[model samples]
Structures are given as structure tokens and as C-alpha cells.
Target: MPQMIFVNLPVTDLDRSTAFYEAVGATKNPRFSDDTASGMVITDAIHVMLLTHDKWRQFTDRQIPDAKISAQVMLCLSHDSRESVDQVVARAGTAGGRIDPNPVQDYGFMYGRSYADPDGHIWEVMWMDAAAAEAGPEAFAAEAAAT
Candidate 1:
């Protein structure tokens, strides 16, 4: 059987978090979700478990870091094209997310942007040209050096 992965994130508001994930294109699985937690599907193999602060505490003894002030983990996802990357970021902002101050990366062959969700969880959307990526590091170096 193929293995699946679930990333559990502590959220201050379960309802809000669930709504945010839905807005960002995740489908909720009712089987593993309840009043205190939500299971958001990112793909067939990956899922995100949004747990309320109280529910989160039951799984871990460490304190949950304030996402607004602390950086614990950043989740990045790939898009099919550069425009798709921009579209998702814009949608995130419209849905109450904060676009990170980090500059957009345009390597001629790749592009991406980062943003913080309502809970301040960092998420990055990126795109890479398959042909360019397959060309290797030397191609990247040459392109950057020429700029």
C-alpha cells in the first residue's frame, strides 16, 4: 500500500481554520474531523490536520509557538505555472492571508511567492519549468550570472 502523510497544525480557531483551508482549495474529510479538529486534504497522499489549541495540547507537551511571531515550519507547494502561483497567492490575500515581504523569485525558469495564512502559518507557492529544471544546476548558474 502507498503511504500517506498528515501534517498536524495547531490552530486557534477550528472553524476559521477549516474555512480558510476550504477557501484555499482543500476538501475536508468528515471522517477524521470534528468540532475540535479538521482534516483538510491537500492531495490523495497528503492531508493537513487542523487541531484546536486544546486538542493540540493532548498530542504534544511542548507549547505551541505563536505563528505570528515565531517560525517553526514553512509548507511549500508547487503549481503548474507561474500564473497559477500568483493566482493562489492573490486568493490567499483576499481570503485574509498576509503576503510575505520576501521578494518574488524569478530565475527565468522558475517563479514563486510566499504568504502567511490567517493563523500565520507560512505557505509558499512555486512553479518551475520542467525543461529548465532538467537542464541542471549549470543552466541555473548561467542564467543567474547573465542577469
Candidate 2:
């Protein structure tokens, strides 16, 4: 079986968070979702577990920092193209997320943008040319300079 990743996030409003995720293209996996938590499937290998503060406490004793004020981690996902990256960020904004919380990144062969969820967790969407990536940054830079 292929390895999978489950990213767990503490949400202030479970329903709102779930809706926002849905608007950003994640589908709720009802099998593992309930009143206090939701399982949002981003892809076959990427799942996001949105948990209420109370539910999050059950897993850890550490205090939950306000994501709106402080960032604990920045999550990123890659897309097939730059347009796909922009589309997701736009959807996130329409769903009440803070668009471009971080500055955008654009290299000749790569591009990225970011958005903050309603609860203030930042997620970055990026795209890179497969050939450029396979050839590595040094090779791409050399080719760009030659051109």
C-alpha cells in the first residue's frame, strides 16, 4: 500500500472549517467524521483531520496556540500547474480564507501562493515544471542563464 499522510488541525468552528475545506476541494470522509471532528480528504494520500478545541485536547496536553496570532507550522501542497495553484487559492478566498498571507513565490520554472484558513492556519499551493524539477535547480539556472 502507498504511504499516506493525515494532517490534524485544531479548528475554532468545526462546521465552518469543514465547509472551508470543502470549498477548497477537499471532500469530507463521513466514515471518520463526527460532531467534534471531520475527516477532509485532499487526495488519495493526503487527509486533513479538523478537530474542535475540546477534541484536540484529548490528543495533547500542550496549550493550543492561536493560529491567528502565531504560526506553528506552514503546510504546502503541490499542483500539476500554476493555474491549479491559483484556482485553489481563489477558492479559499471565496470560502472566507485570508488570501496571500505570505508573499507569493515565483521562479522561472516554479510558482507558489498561500492562503490562511478561517482559523489562520496557512496553506501554500505550488507548482513546478516536472522537467525543470527533475533536472534540478542548478541545471535550470544554468539553462536560463544560457538563454
Candidate 3:
């Protein structure tokens, strides 16, 4: 079986968090979800587990980080196109998220932008073309000039 990554996040309100993820295009997996927690499917191998504060504590002895004021982890995902990255962030904002000051720009072959969810969880949306990335920033500029 292929290894998978499960990103566990502590949420003050499970319902609100579930709704936010749904709005951002993740589907809830009923088989692994319940009133206390929900598994949001980002991809076949990647998932975000949104657990209530109490439920989260049951999984660890340490205190949950105050995502609103602290940085525990920054979750990032890549898109197939630049417009898709913008769409995700835009949807997040419409769902009560806030956009970070930075904008997406061509950095060699990577283009991405960051945002904060309603609960202040940081998420970076990016679009990277492998061919463009392999060409490097200098090559990209030269190709653009030639075009």
C-alpha cells in the first residue's frame, strides 16, 4: 500500500471548519468522519483531519497550538494552473478566509500565494509547471525574451 499523509488540525468549532473545507473543494469522508472530527479529502494520498479541541487533545499530551496567534505548520497544495491557485484562495476568502499580502508571481517555475483560513490556519496555494521549473528562472526569462 502507498503511504499517505494525514494532516491533523485542531479546530475550535468542528462544524465551521468542516464547512470551510467543503467550500474550498474538499469532500468529507464519512467513513473516517463523525461529529467529533471530519476527514477532508485533498487527494487520494493527502487528507486533512479536522478535530475539535477536545478530540485533538485526546490524541496528544501536548497542548494544541493557538493557530490564531501561532504558527504550528503551514499547509500547502499545488494546482495544475495559475487560475486554479487563484480560485482556491478566492474561494477560501469567500468562505471567511483572509488573503495574505503576497501575490502569485513566476519564481522560476513555481507560482503560489498564501492565505489564512477563518481559524487563522495558513495555507499556500501554488501552481508549478515542471518544464518551466526545470528551465530555471534565467532560462525562463531568456525564452520569454525570444518569444
Candidate 4:
């Protein structure tokens, strides 16, 4: 079996966070969900666990940073096409998330956009041409020099 990954995040409101992720195409997995936690399945390999602040504290004593004030980490996702990236951003906005503060980037070989969820967790989505990405540094350098 392949390795699976789960990103656990602390949320102020369990229901709200669950709803936001559901809007982004995640499905709730009841096997791992409860009153204080919800499992949002993004894909077969990737899942996100939304844990209430109270439940999160039981695991660690580290302070949970305020999502509105400071960024602890940024999550990134990949899409098959540029249009898919745009779609994700739009869905996020309609779900009460904020639009990407930065302009979309298109480098011919790669494209990307970023948006923040209602809880202020930034999510970046990108699409890359497999051929160009496989070309590695040379391709990036050429694109950079041309811009």
C-alpha cells in the first residue's frame, strides 16, 4: 500500500471548518470524525483532520497561533490545468474564503494562484507542464531570463 498523509489543523469552529473544506471538494469521513474533530478527505492519499482548539490542546502544549495574525504554514495543491486552479480559487471565495492577494502567475510552462480560507489558512494551487518541469533548472532559468 502507498503511504497516506494527513494534515491536522486546529480550528476555532469544527462545523464551520468542515463546511469550508467540503466546499473545496472534500468529503467527510465518519470513521474518523466526532464532535471535536472532522476528517476531510481530499483524495485517496491526502486527508485533513480538522480538530477543535480544545481537542488540539490535548495533543500538545504549544500555543496555537491566530490564523488572522500570523501564518504558521501554507498549504499547496496541484491541478491538471490552469482552469482547475481558477476553479478552486472561485469555489473558495464562494465558500466565504478570501481571494488571492497576489496576481495569478503564468510562466508558459507553469501556472499558479493562491487563496486563503475563511480561517485565514492560505492555500496555493499550481499547474505545471510535465515536460517543462522535467527539464529542471535550465527551463526555469530560461523562463526567468525571458521575463
What TM-score, computed on C-alpha atoms, does each candidate reach?
A: 0.92, 0.97, 0.88, 0.91
User: Lowest lDDT 10-mer window, candidate 3?
Assistant: 100-109
TM-score leader: 2
For model 4, what is the error of residue 141's alpha carbon versus the real structure, in angstroms, after optimal superposition? 5.4
Candidate 2 ranges beyond 4 A from true positions: none
In candidate 1, what are the lDDT values of residues 59-113, reduced to their tens digit?
Answer: 9899899999998988888999998898888888888888864578887788889
**How many residue pairs of model 4 clash at the backbone?**
0
Instruction: Give the per-residue lDDT of model 2 (tens digit) for 1-147.
Output: 999999999999999999999999999999999999999999999999999999999999999999999999999999999999999999999999999999999987899999999999999999999999999988988999999
Model 3 segments beyond 4 Å from truth? 101-105, 141-147
Q: What does each candidate score in C-alpha RMSD?
A: 1.7, 0.7, 2.0, 2.1
**What is the C-alpha lDDT profile of model 3 across 43-66, one tens digit per residue?**
999999999888998989897878
Supply candidate 2's per-residue lDDT for 120: 98
Query: Model 1's lDDT to the true fold?
Result: 0.88
Quote the positional error of residue 43 for candidate 2 in Å. 0.7
Which pairs clash (backbone N, Cα, C closer than 3 Å) in model 4? none
**Residue 69: error of model 3 in Å?**
1.4
Better model by TM-score: candidate 1 vs candidate 2:
2
For TM-score, candidate 1 versus 3, the one ahead is 1
